[model samples]
Target chain A: MITPSPALPIAVPLVAAAFLAGLRKFLRRWLADLIATATAAANLWLCTALLRASWHSNIVYWFGNWFPRGRMVVGIGFEVDPVGAGLATLACLLTLLGFIYSWRITDSGRDLFQPLMLIFMAAMCGFAMTADLFNLFVFFELMSTAAFALCGLKTHEPAPLQGAFNFAVTNTVGAFLILTGIALVYAVTGALNMAQIGFLLGSRHDLLVIAAAAFLCSGFLIKAAIAPFHFWLPDAHSVAPTPVCVLFSGLMVELGAFAVLRMTSVMFGQSLLQPHSAFRATLLLLGSLTVVWGGLMCFAEHHLKRVLAFSTISHGGAMLLGVAIGTPAAITGWLTYLFAHAMAKAGLFFTAGILLHRLQSMSEPQLFKRGRPLRFTAVLWLLGGIALAALPPFGLSNGEDLIESATHAHAIHLWVTLMFFFTSAMTGAAVFRVGMRVFFGLGDAGPADRAAKIDEAPDGPEEQHHIPARMFLPAALCIALSAAPAYIPGFGRWFFNAAHRFLAQSLYIARIYAQPVHYVLPPAPHSDLGSTLMHGAIAVVCALLLASWAVFHLALPRGFRGATHLEGPMFPLRKLQSGHPGDYVVWCMVGFVLLGGCLFLLP
Target chain B: MNQIVHIFPYLVAGWVFLCGLYGIATSRHLVHTVISLAVVQTSTYVLLLNIGFRTGGAAPVFADISPGITTVDPIVQALMLTDVVVEATVMALLLAMVVKAYEKAGTLSPDDLRLMRG
Candidate 1:
């Protein structure tokens, strides 16, 4: 009988973050690790207890014990449903594991790292549990800001700084759009609580509502790094520290997809489920494009981390495609894929980190030349790669089977399913290529590669310098978790059922209020008319004209040299080295104007 | 008359918000961005207050005096107060980060700070 308290997880980390900020000078490096590990551990415990209790009952906490007076609810509230509770628990556990993974890295300022990590945890928990829109925005800001700081932890490195800067700008734009959407929705509904608003606008459709939904979805999509908005993801994930990379690629992007699920379910549930159509086509199109784009990009990349990053984007698209299908089986597939991918990706990152630590390089060619002696790391990485590629015996394979069987009847569904499978195969091939290079290629340690050798005295056992026991333990746990769904009967049902219920509840509400929602309508009715025609033309032209031109230009040797030269100068652009306040102001202004105009004019 | 009064504050808040956004968009300095964000935040606060306002609403604060006029929407006011606190914290933190950046980079021009790329 654990009483669900809303403030414990959020409050604990927030206070610890502030305290660590002040104690930076006295406690030094150990302080960050100690505080971060403790707070994450506490959060994990609290969420686990909440999960257990929530299995049998629901917990609702009201701010100041304020009850609704005449339908105008004044008090802020947090409700811990089974789904939210489960997600929160898993999020906390993974964050704790991530912190443990980073325990040995002393190069970065420990003081700042601990506080940022705590804030990140707090923000994530707050995002998962908050029932109010404005509060959601606040939590969103906290998480993004913390992420920005953490991404730039190693400021001396150009790659990390650039990656963090790009991530910051794009995500800030996304956040602004979310805020604008919130404001618009507030104007229309006059209620902050999600359930209350859903109830109030249950039977209405309007331009305002559609605009709001679009704005909100765009923000989350960018955060999730779904195709066109995905440019910032690879660099950020590849450049950040290994543990941070794992968290960013594994958990943070998923949060965006989760947000889209939550918002669509809560606000526009009915519209999404209309028998004839809704936003499904748009989602499917984006999802399929992201799948192909990510797979192809992975094939082109030489950097191990960047390849993993592209793989994440590809898998994210597949998950979104499942959700877009909006069927019971599809939702099941989505949840299953979410959990499985998190484990697999985190394990891969961990292994990658160990390799980088041992070899002092992330380049595939260099890594291949100086072969890693650690067989355990290779084995784990192979297992992780297999799971990521959705091979048989992996949980993702089962999830994909369910999704394919369920959606095989419809043409669009079938196409999407095929695309997803194709991408998975491509991803597997890419991983195999890299793996072959590293494990089987000729071992030619170049002249400069002398630095890669670890100094050990003659007749002394080779110093381990491998992954710490704590880190390896978690990686193994994750790998085991990835394999569990195939062996354990109905193990995934708990999460799947929760996701289904969430989707069903929203659909139920949307069905009830589909007619009165006159103000917030979508951009036109269906994707079958002018937009489809335009898309067809564009695709044809791109294939016929642009494709050949690109190939021809890329084929010439001078073209390759010229391209590399051009790319060399642009390398420094990645650092966000611009110290000019004027440019930042202009960028911010332009973003604001564009966002503001869209909000005001769209209706 | 009642409707007019009710809508007047919303209009004012909207105008103020637009102006603040404009300032934020045009301003070149880091401090200016913070100030602009504050202004945008203030617009929301005003809107919250306006939503809660009654024609002759009394102050929401509790005191020794007996309840006289209708108490304003205490809920909105409380939420607004919390928002102000959040905004203040965000502004202060941004300022601190800006100062740190200035110390390290020797300039605040975002255009000039090009240390990273693809």
Candidate 2:
């Protein structure tokens, strides 16, 4: 068998997207869908090949075969490590699943949907694999451009237009911030390749480096939907179509966290990883804040999609914590968590899409007592919630175990554990509460709010009485496969070795120069499964209790129930999410200023 | 004055970026907001170009110049070119959305676009 090149994952999707886009007028919808699906599958296969090839060594493929001149890298390179290729594979996998789920829906723009999805997939693959900073920016723009257009796909309503608009503006600004940082880094190092930059910037802790770190981190953090810069996420996710939401929440946002990890490890390794680095603390604080804010909003909102969106933000924070910890074990946990979250979150969104298709609504109250017929889907939804809570036997719990064990010696390990517990419980409770209210009719009327009243356009050409087999298949597979990794014996040990290489800046630099270095694999860290299970059990119980309270609180004594109402306290916080583009811009500025100040002003 | 000249472009880039942000935070019309974003993007071009500039250096071309001659950095110029195209495409997409928003809601004021508020 011929070995697949690293560029095929990016090239196949790009060419297919252009082909589908160019012949859009001539091609039938089904034909276009077939081409897109085939392209995604091809990309996934190629990425898997690269992932396996890169299992032990980082594979660097230079574009145009332009080899580095002695010490200088003159050509753009795709440095494919297992983690990067694995992310690209996940992006392709999610795109393929989304296409399958969306096959029945007669998209608003007949041929526009598949091409954009292909382009988005292509961009994500490129973003995950590129070692060139400028190329990364280019792919970032490509991804955002495709996403913005896709968000506004439902043009019949003004909400999607508004959502897409805010998403475009904020993310565009973030991209620009990243570009500025790239400029600074190029100025200092005269290089754009991450490995070259790292080599040139060895042990430097200058102001330019600090400023560049701030700018890059700020930009990607915004994309990651870290709080204070996260105002645009809910608005965008809640308004976009369901399959599109799957991509947005599943892999796109998490790629931001992935970028931060790659950038810090490759380019700013020596400076940022030194002891007493405030950058680490700043990230931890931001992650904690995102966790609390997202968890609270996830439970408070009644719109099913918005609840899922906020839960994404919360889980995104947990991933950021793993990145911030900056250990091989922690990153291994991050990768596992990302896989589980992507699968489980996509499953949850699919369930939401099912609800929308059947009941013609996404609000819990509007959908209350109406989803009793979807008994199988309810089971899937409940399982999805349990997996999301990181309960034992689920893949997410295994990921949490690794992260918790990795942080066991840190000063703020307890705080990290608490944040993880809070996020899982609150987000899981929101899902459980929605499931009980809509599926089982176990709850009193859900609370009414302005957010729940927002207009939503349902997916598919028309509503159906019977659930389609295609729709059920993807959600079931996603939830089932989400737990598969945890059950795979010895997967953790293998993943830890891959992650250790991912964090080795010197090893990457050596690879780029075509020089071999002696490298030793550290002993695979042991996961404290017993403690992890205990924590997971507590979180699951808390989720159940919280869901029960949200549903049955009205039956309690008057004073107790009066105190139980939590939405009142959240009004001010929610008010910050005014959905105005200007307000979001203001928050972006505030976040940038604070991030810059914290990163640059600290001693 | 030499030092001042060297730093002037950097200051201007920073100033332009902040000004564009201010325009976005205060803008009432969607058109104005898009323009503000364009302004923000322009600062990147300025920054990238300024970083590549070398005083008294020739353009990075070898048609008539000696191989060892001092020349401005060509890579940053190439980067800026791509950045400009990306900025233009983003602006066009934003404007398209603005036109759609205007037709659907019959208003362009940010305040009136409160249909998604909490």
Per-candidate clashes come to 46, 0
- TM-scores, in order shown? 0.76, 0.98
Q: Compared with the true structure, what per-residue lDDT tens digits does model 2 show for residues A1-603?
A: 455888888788888988989999998778888888888888888888888888878899999999799899999999998889888988988888888888848467567889899989989999998999999999999999999999988888888898899899899889989999999999899999999999999989988998898899989988999998998899899888888899999999999998999999999889787744788778888999999999988888888899999999999999888888878988889888898999999999998888888888888788898888889989999999999999867788878878877878778889989999999999999999988888889857677778787778677656778778888888998998788767788878877877899999999889999998788998988777788789888998999988888788878767766323554335567888888888887888788888888887776
lDDT, candidate 2, at A172: 89
Cα lDDT tens digits, model 1, A1-603, are 566486798898889889988877887566667778888999898988877775533466777887555556566777666667767777787888887877746356445776887888888888887777778878888888788778767654444554565566556656656765676677678788776677677756667677677777777887887876676677567667777777787788988888887777776666444442456666776788779878766544557787788889888888888867877666666777777788888888887777776666666656774544677877887788677767645667666655665576777766865766655665665565556557655322111211112111111123246556776777777877886766777655665556555665543333222222222211211112232233323323332232223223345566443323211323332233232232343444443444335434433
Could you tell me which residue pairs clash in candidate 2? none
Candidate 2 global lDDT? 0.88
Q: Once model 1 is optimally superposed onto the true structure by TM-score, how far is the C-alpha of residue B76 displaced, in angstroms?
A: 6.2
Candidate 1 regions off by >4 Å? Answer: A1-4, A28-35, A69-71, A442-466, A506-603, B1-116
Individual DockQ of the candidates? 0.25, 0.86
**What do the candidate models score in CA lDDT, each in turn?**
0.65, 0.88
